[model samples]
Target: MTAATTAAPVGHDTAPTGHDLAEVGRSPATLRTFLHGLPGVDQVGADQRAAMLATRSIKTTAKAWAIDLAIRMVDLTTLEGADTPGKVRALGAKARRPDPTDAGCPPVAAVCVYPAMVPVAAEALAGSGVHLASVATAFPAGQAPLDVKLADTRAAVAAGADEIDMVISRGAFLAGRYHEVYDEIVAVKQTCGDAHLKVILETGELASYDNVRRASWLAMLAGADFIKTSTGKVPVAATLPVTLIMLEAVRDFHAVTGRRIGVKPAGGIRTTKDAIRYLVLVNETAGDGWLTPDLFRFGASSLLNDLLMQRAKLATGAYSGPDYVTLD
Candidate 1:
């Protein structure tokens, strides 16, 4: 089916009522109980569902449309110690014009960078429709003290980050210190001010599917605009099953809260086929609203190039090598 194919709309199954909201005040005990009470994730069922979704087939035209949509949803990123101003500018330029030869190519959703490079990215992406998202809060580890994490978040927002991707404290969460994790997220959300917050759960380190589900609920409860799967630093980054669990979390979170939260699967996803498969998962699981960049994003850099090559092939009926697209 084409990306434009319409699907039957579904309403919230368990939208949080006023009583539920009031019951889940900032109290850690209440929050912990609520999160722990979330429906347990059946790993076998979830893995089966993700595997089934990945096997979906799309025609050429539909795949093309999905490719463009995937490109638009990409958070074109560069988060390396070697990241320099010149490299950031080049990345911004590529994000703005992913396929310079084709005017039909759409700009990516945003340019993700380290907090210190936000100014460089801002300057490079100026006038482009791309947003600036920075990774902060002792990213990848989330091991630092609460004060330090908040300061990191505030500095990134001050540097002009439209979105802050904060990593949750896996150490605390694994230690069963759910309250500590929830409170840290709440504090960081406040520091974000107008900027959006995307909380990374680092699912790989979370151990089981159950912890991922609980962490998802905890992040959403603490006021994350988007719930992400990983920090891209761990050995096992984003995976289909992990991402599917996160998507289900957002879908369920919206049901009770009447709030729309985004889901981002970062790290390992690197092909048009993989991205389209994810879009299919979103379409079937979260409904239509989450299909947009506002509610969904792919945290990727190399994924863009493969998409460009595929788009070029579709346009010219010829294989365009890596040389055709800008390398960032």
Candidate 2:
């Protein structure tokens, strides 16, 4: 695969601080020890490639779609005429307004939109049984000040988002500014109120399994409700090896703190089959509890269409247009 194909999409044009994986001093022995303990980390090798391919032949089922594969699709989804709060509200209303029998895929775990679109999703999903998620804190580029990041988190929640996804200050993080990274997450978590906080590590830039693990643990210690990989806007994102390392982090964090933070692999997933591999990872690593929509999610822009198409194929044994069920 091309470097562009697998590069993390989250960190882009942030202030370059001459940081890379080598600068972090992440211990390979530590990452290996952690990986060995995870149930499926071994699959990060040749087997992962085999498994990803295997999922291609597995048919999509409604039950699996709802229980295993549904997640908030983001990064690439753009709003039409969402220039004003009113337009956002209308889009939210449209998303909130779905039919009980309209092929019935689980309304995505939530609607993820730009910070400007948070209120629209919040207002639109309100009382409709869906949730609102927003990307904030100099998102995709975590190169802003700590207070600014905290303020961004606070702003998103104030505007009606129930969840906030923030990028870590890669510059600080790569400088071995662990305390800065820790404090930023803690502050953001504090500002969350009733909202959930998803900390994005932008793993591809981290460049190795060890840094990914360290970043994961640091975020969990600092108070993240979930740990996500990439913003789907960068070069490398959501790869199996990176995800394997992150999964180990979640498992280790759970053992240490008894808290289960969610895991979301965003960026490159564009097919239902790929989604299922992530499902299998969740099931095998975190067990049945992680199988629910609450703990596991896939972030994608074009993935929804593939899912819908596959779902329709299961029902009628024929293909259908993804736009045929337009939310508008």
Global lDDT scores for all candidate models: 0.86, 0.65
> Which runs of model 1 end up more than 4 angstroms from their true locations?
1-18
TM-score per model over all chains: 0.94, 0.77
- Per-residue CA lDDT of candidate 2, range 150-186, in tens? 7888888888888888899888877766766767787
> How do the residues 44-163 of candidate 1 rate in per-residue lDDT, one tens digit apiece?
878887898889878788888889999999999888999999999899888898877778789999999999999999999888879999999988788798899999999988888989
Rate residue 214 of model 2 by lDDT.
Answer: 67
What does candidate 1 score on TM? 0.94
Best-performing candidate as measured by TM-score: 1
